[model samples]
Target: MDIQKDQILETRVRLELDAKDLRNYAKKATGYSFALEDIAEHLESTVELLKSIEKLKSQEEQDQYQIGQQVVYVDEFMPDTVEIITSIVDGWVSFNNGSRGCIAVMIRPANQDEIKANKRLMVA
Candidate 1:
């Protein structure tokens, strides 16, 4: 995501620079100006908005899980199964149920009802 954002920012910067060059040339030739300056301003605002959105998304993801937190593991075989988070590395979440041991799977933070239901299960 960061790499993609960096590439977009670079492209926007290049476009803004190109727009400025065109504005200068147009002014000299036609004795009038293009709306390139407004376009550049809009480009900058767009970049800022993108950055803000990415930051919010990152923060929301970080707030979603933590080490030792209980979560719901959802997959084809085991939908809404409860598991406990063991670790998170590079956006990969690792979790375990008592029997399965540590395994990485698609997970979401378990809700109160799910947690209560999970607690009612017995080993027998």
Candidate 2:
């Protein structure tokens, strides 16, 4: 059977993003990590309860980075900080403290009429 072109393209992008995110999460957690198949099982899940649980995602994102001027941004409370970055007054970000007492900032952006929304269906 032939594969659909759009699905193949979208799947590649999604896999890339998923790997990046899982690696980032793993790097921040302690000790070893679960198997990739196990992680995929957890990711395929869509339970709201899992969303609230907030367990560590991956073991690579924490232990994998070099710490000399490569980090972009992270909380001071976090360990294994490798690099930090600021937008130099050019970026607008929004954040909320949720139930916690942390301070937060809000951002609102305006776009031109010709701008297009982001999509993961990238073509190589």
- Please, what are the lDDT tens digits per residue for candidate 2 over residues 1-124? 6444344445555655676576666667566445554564455453323332222211222233322212212343333222222221112221221121111111112122212322112211
Please give each candidate's TM-score: 0.46, 0.27
Which runs of model 1 end up more than 4 angstroms from their true locations? 1-34, 75-81, 89-91, 96-106, 111-124
Root-mean-square deviation of candidate 1: 8.6
**Tens digit per residue, CA lDDT, model 1, 1-124:** 3444446557656765766676576567552444655665675677566667655555555567888887765554455467777766544566653334333335556777778887313221
Model 1 is weakest, by summed lDDT over 10 consecutive residues, at 97-106
| Model 2 spans > 4 angstroms off | 34-124
State each model's CA lDDT, in order: 0.59, 0.32
Candidate 2: C-alpha lDDT:
0.32
Give the number of the best model, judged by TM-score: 1
